[model samples]
Target: MVLCHDEIDAVNDMQNLVAAPSLRVTTVQQSSHTTLLLCSAYNFYPQQIQMTWLQNGEEVTSDVISTDVLSDGNIYYQIHSYLEHKPKPGEQISCMVEHVSLSEPLVQVWDPHPPRPLTERVKIAVGTFFLVVGLTALVVGIIKNKKRTAALCTVMHENLVAAPSLRVTTVQQSSHTTLLLCSAYNFYPQQIQMTWLQNGEEVTSDVISTDVLSDGNMYYQIHSYLEHKPKPGEQISCMVEHVSLSEPLVQVWVYFHCFDTGGVLLRVNIGALYLQSKVYRIGQLYMISKHSHEQSERGEGVEVVQNEPFEDPEHGEGQFTEKRIYLNNKLPSWARAVVPRIFYVTEKAWNYYPYTITEYTCSFLPKFSIHIETKYEDNKGTNDHIFGSEPREEETEVCVVDIAYDEVPERHYKESEDLRHFKSKKTERGLLPEGWMDTQDPIMCSYKLVTVKFEVWGLQTRVEQFVHKVIRDVLLLGHRQAFAWIDEWIDMTMEEVREYERATQEATNQKIGSFPPAISITETALPINVRNGPNSAPSTPLSTEAPDFLSVPKERPRKKSAPETLTLPDPGRRDSIFKLPSFFSWNSSPQPE
Candidate 1:
């Protein structure tokens, strides 16, 4: 530990030195004719510094761009200066940095010269060898295995899957309709197929499929949508057929509910019959009706719903979709390899947009990460009156609720400009909330209570943006089959808590490191020593008995009782046996007396 401490201190001291500017000259692949010289100085303390690029001992100010001084989070600063040049043989490039902490200015140089003859010879020889081998292998391969390659291509054409992952998400724009989306991603070849089935029968009409999109890294994704009134026990599935799969991948979802109440209103309760081992966000489920199990079991015909334009004087819920900027996943892979990644890297960049999007069901997406909850609700004060039929004159009010630790957010939510991050709070009695005082379903009596959980790990602070984006993602991602995956709900995991703490600590350290040092250091504690008073007995003798605790119970006294006498029998015989038991002899003698 001591050694580690010393090493850390030594590192800090060394990093505090005036950094020596280093230069790297390299060719730009984008501009084949020009070379770029990069000069960097890092880990220098005392913020004021001077940096300049030099060409042949003369300052080269043109075609040079230098970055603003940036702190490396310890009061030390770093800067990168770039110079683009068309270099000739024997040309030189250098950078100079001047700082008050330095005894002298530091200069670093990069010499650009053509490769040595030996190196040129090695490159030519390797190229020639590879060319000869390639020609020979090409001729042999063509002559020997053309037929085999053709057969494999045929097989692959029939079974290859472009996408490896799938997910479905749903959002309710209104209590009347739920949008279901089917997403497939992490692809190889783009040859793919998709279909939707209701109660095992393929629904042809009202189903829309998207053109396959490429991430440019050889992966592809596509979406499919189905608009219809849901029935219970209705086995809704998105069947994807890919060349790499021998059998089509079929993901089934059933959202069914029944009525068990005999009250004034027919209270409908939703039953989930989805058997697939998949996870769905808890928020999107709110916008759905309980599947009519009896209706589906009896092979009832489902009502086909069409995609009505929300802005068409018809609905306000669909207006949220206008702000959605979709999956722009066409980015290059970090790996120089050919295999595509499971999750799209470009997806994170898409999130930087002002709008938030929900993946109603991107079938293969590992998780749904949105910052909103979606649900169908019985219109509370207005009548149409009070439910999913007609919109009232009032502008649609959408509530973005926080599901505190995956629970309903009826309480402890901060609302600013219509955004909310649900926080867990103690009850009036100061205990963890166990009942539904505030946690009750927002759309209670409307149907099922649905909340869409977002992957809002770092978004708690951005209330307005978080809330708006959440509402947008839900509208865009929700389709007919999007809400099929059963959610695996849990609170904060130990690993997650630890990771959060670790990140917070790092951020705090970085912030603290960038500040100026303390001008006046305070002592850790007051340093005053006192001599003990003369060791002597007290003036009065100390009481020996221990103090009694008023609240503690005292031992009860035992009740005294007389001991009972036991009579023995007399000897059955004078010499061999007792005449009677002692009790009989004692009683008989007493009677005689």
Candidate 2:
């Protein structure tokens, strides 16, 4: 059966086969040559292929290069060849490939031409003749058709500018129809009027708002809502208009329907078209409609399923967390009251120990017994009785009996009872006072009397008999505290010293005379003397020249003198006229003559 033209066209499109051979033609400019030619073919096998280059219908030799067959099972292959030198005059170079079921091999040819030579005078004469004739013809054409051509060209160019390029993005599809969203870009402002034309009439009711360009330039975009079940060969168009354009630009969008088992059968197809034979900027979007033909034939339907939820390990419940500490109670009431007082006394004793205690005695006897008596014989003698001694007569005698003694027992006593017995014996023999006793007693009297003695002895024994004796003493509580005060004082002093050093260094490093020298009284003494009392003449003015009239000094207003006092002559007596003496030389000289 003979197929219709559409069916034949479809069949030809389905063939999906193309073949091209590698054509290598070299063009050399005395010192340079072109590279090899590479070509490709579709729906062809290389093993069943033959490639060759023919020069003037003769097979090329070894000097002309060629490549091996490269292909897959499909109708696609590529190969390369090189020509060694530029072809001579009238030389024809062709690459040909042979295939099965093909009456003729595919051929591509490169024909080279030699340079033409002409005399300079003849060339100039020919150019002048052509120039005159071309100018005459151009002038005649313009005179004959100037207005018509200008109007036609203007209309054509305007139509090209207004022509719409359509693009459709297929958002989603349903069983009845495919949902398509269409957009157009690069449209001029004058061509922004858009309408959806169904069949031949304009569609105006279902229009959405148009989006104008934000830039001050001329451009706009508009969207329209369309719902239709498209069939094969159905025509739909998006038309645009602008007053500036001579003719309206129209873009026809053709719709096609296809069938698939899982989807509805609705498709829209669009291709670009030129108007007025001028170039137009067009964009297109296509939404393809699928039909459920196979499913309908088999009596089956397709279903969509939702995805399951996912759990992330990073957000799990049993993750590593930080711990915080909470304090349930503040300082105890007893401690709050006592700690401050204790700290104060201890601080005071540490500051004033040396000066407070002028004499101290430490003694150690048999059986590892130890005694220490600190006689804080105050310089003012307030605690002198505590040492069981009279007030000293002199300041120098206050420390006169300061003694420290240590005696290591041949054997150490294991228990406090043995130390007690030894201490009792020493007390009875007058080696120690009757009040002296071991410090291991709970009575207050025992502590006040003997605890001090034992502490002194312990310190002495540790110093002389034991491996370690660590002694730390300060003169007075105030003296120990003074050390801390002195440290602060030293720091402040050092800071002051450093600041002074920095100031001196800055002054030394600066350039000499960068600052004016300070005025001294001796240097400021004036060389010129004036009659004004006490005050000296003012210093020299900054400028050397006399000032202009506008800046000159002005005169001060003169003060009026008091009227002269007059006295009346006594009573009513007549006043005699007296004349002061003047030299009489002129009268005497006349008399002598």
Best by TM-score: 1
lDDT of 1 at 31: 39
Ten contiguous residues with the weakest lDDT in model 1? 584-593
Per-residue lDDT value at 236 in model 1: 68
Model 2 lDDT tens row, 25-89: 43333223322232333345334676666667765432333334444323355444433344466
The predictions' CA RMSDs to the true structure, in order, are 35.3, 56.8
lDDT by residue for model 1 over 298-399, one digit each (tens)? 111111111111211221112111011112132124221322332221111011011112122111222222211122233221222222334332222222
Residue runs of model 2 more than 4 Å from their true location after superposition: 1-170, 180-182, 215-218, 263-593
Model 2, total clashes? 30
lDDT of each: 0.35, 0.28
Error of 1 at 538 (Å): 62
Q: Give the C-alpha miss distance for residue 98 in model 2, angstroms.
A: 64
Output the lDDT of residue 272, model 1: 20
